[model samples]
Target: MAEPRFSRFAAIDWSGAQGHRHKGIAVAVCATGDAAPTLVAPPGASAWSRDDVLDWLLCQDTSTLIGLDLSPAFPFVDQDGYFPGAPDSPLDARALWKMVDDASAADPHLAVSSLLTDPEIRRHFRQHRDCGDLFPGGAGRMRVCEHGQRTMGLSPTSCFNLVGAAQVGKSSLTGMRVLHRLAGRLPVWPFDPLPPHGPAIVEIYTTIAARAAGIRKGLSKMRDAVSLDTALANLGSQPHRPLARYDDHATDAILTAAWLRANADRAELWRPQAMTPHIARTEGWTFGVS
Candidate 1:
């Protein structure tokens, strides 16, 4: 049997202070037949800026596809073709929609009129039906749920999931698929071997858990909230609200944990490290990610 083309692949989970600065930009790379993936940090004392991150990412000579969990671009189809999400100041959900409009006009092939109603798109979107309401243009809208309807301020089940809904879930789905694809391409630059399957899962778990544990510790340190209610109050006036945003530190850590737990392999290798200046310098990875 032919070996899978990809042996070395990397999975990165990036986040802010709510997450671990040490593991803020978690990276895991593995190679075929290797006992475990060599988890390395970039050598530096500087934190990663948006541009720096992209520069570093584009600079990676790994030749292997790099899977980034961040929004590389918005995956939406307006009247036209596809549009990539831009990293711009005042970046928000609204800007994303506008770009979709622009992409549609610039390229005729890019229009998404048919894709929205396509059976495959509809089926794939159903997995996240709870969050969005897809409206077939001129065809009226199908209410998916009350919460979605209220959130989009559209008639129940009449709004499109492509817009205000399913952001996190959709991004996650995209990330996982990218990871799988990158894993198929063998390592190219500064190639390192991957640990056994068991250890790999362990490392992934530890990294994610470490981030979660850090968040719990920080909340404790600030005395933000000993209880859920107190924490919510400390954060704002909202009742029963989470201290952290769904896309904030907690979400990333939780998602990372979920990913690790799901991909557990008995033969993988696991290892983690603290962010020490010497270690950071030696590893050639940034110490502080701004």
Candidate 2:
């Protein structure tokens, strides 16, 4: 198969925080021939709002391959929908996105905590507060992609597990709201048909890219200049500015951008064996994961 060629590569480290501007959110970009990826600040702002990121993405002229570090959908295969017993559970991924968008309609920043009001939906998740009776038991509750990630030796938290620092559920929920708005503007990979031109967004896990770049497992974040530079070099990216602090958000964006560029031509990534039609339309597979 011929390699998919894009004019530019970019990645966004997303956040679920309820605010106009988020410090945790970061954007990184690299051109076809650029030496290395550079952090991008939101225009005239110290930090980026979810809206700002969307606006920036829409304004780009080149055909860009964008990676978003968040789950585009939830675990629907096991229960057939996010809320199994509920009367009106979303039938598919697009339906679920609409549900989230509707719930968060008043919240312009895409805050998703309000969805917890539904008792059935809240039962499946473990919030930061000790919700002893609410924790859903066993790995069967996890999505197929989460299970697949563990099988590949990458520890992936369930998108339903909304508690703790490592949980991705909140980010994923908020991200769905953004996706609903970008429906026509950005075609998400494996969900919407890939556009012949313009930008295409895909779900990404930075740890997958980090491991491919030779970073050891168990290290929480990439600190120091040597390790960061080495990981970038492994992706065939030129040396970049040293990290001033141990920041996973910044490092993930930088490394994932290079990883996307390095692996853009790999035919296998575009078509993973496990990416069945149901998975694509509902659960949504992570890019680069087979």
Best by lDDT: 2
**lDDT on C-alpha atoms for all candidate structures:** 0.30, 0.82
Return the top candidate by TM-score: 2
Residue pairs in collision within model 2: none
Worst lDDT run of 10 residues, candidate 1, spans 281-290
Candidate 2 at 266: error in angstroms? Answer: 1.2
Over the stretch 157-237, how does candidate 2's per-residue lDDT look in tens digits? Answer: 878777668888889998998888887777898898667787889999999889988888987378667778888998888
lDDT of 1 by residue, 58-156 (tens): 455532323344332222322221211213311322333333333234322223343334343343243333321333344222211222223423222
- lDDT of prediction 1: 0.30
Q: How much is 285 displaced in model 2, in angstroms?
A: 0.7
Model 2 stretches with alpha carbons more than 4 Å out: 1-4, 130-135, 138-140, 242-246
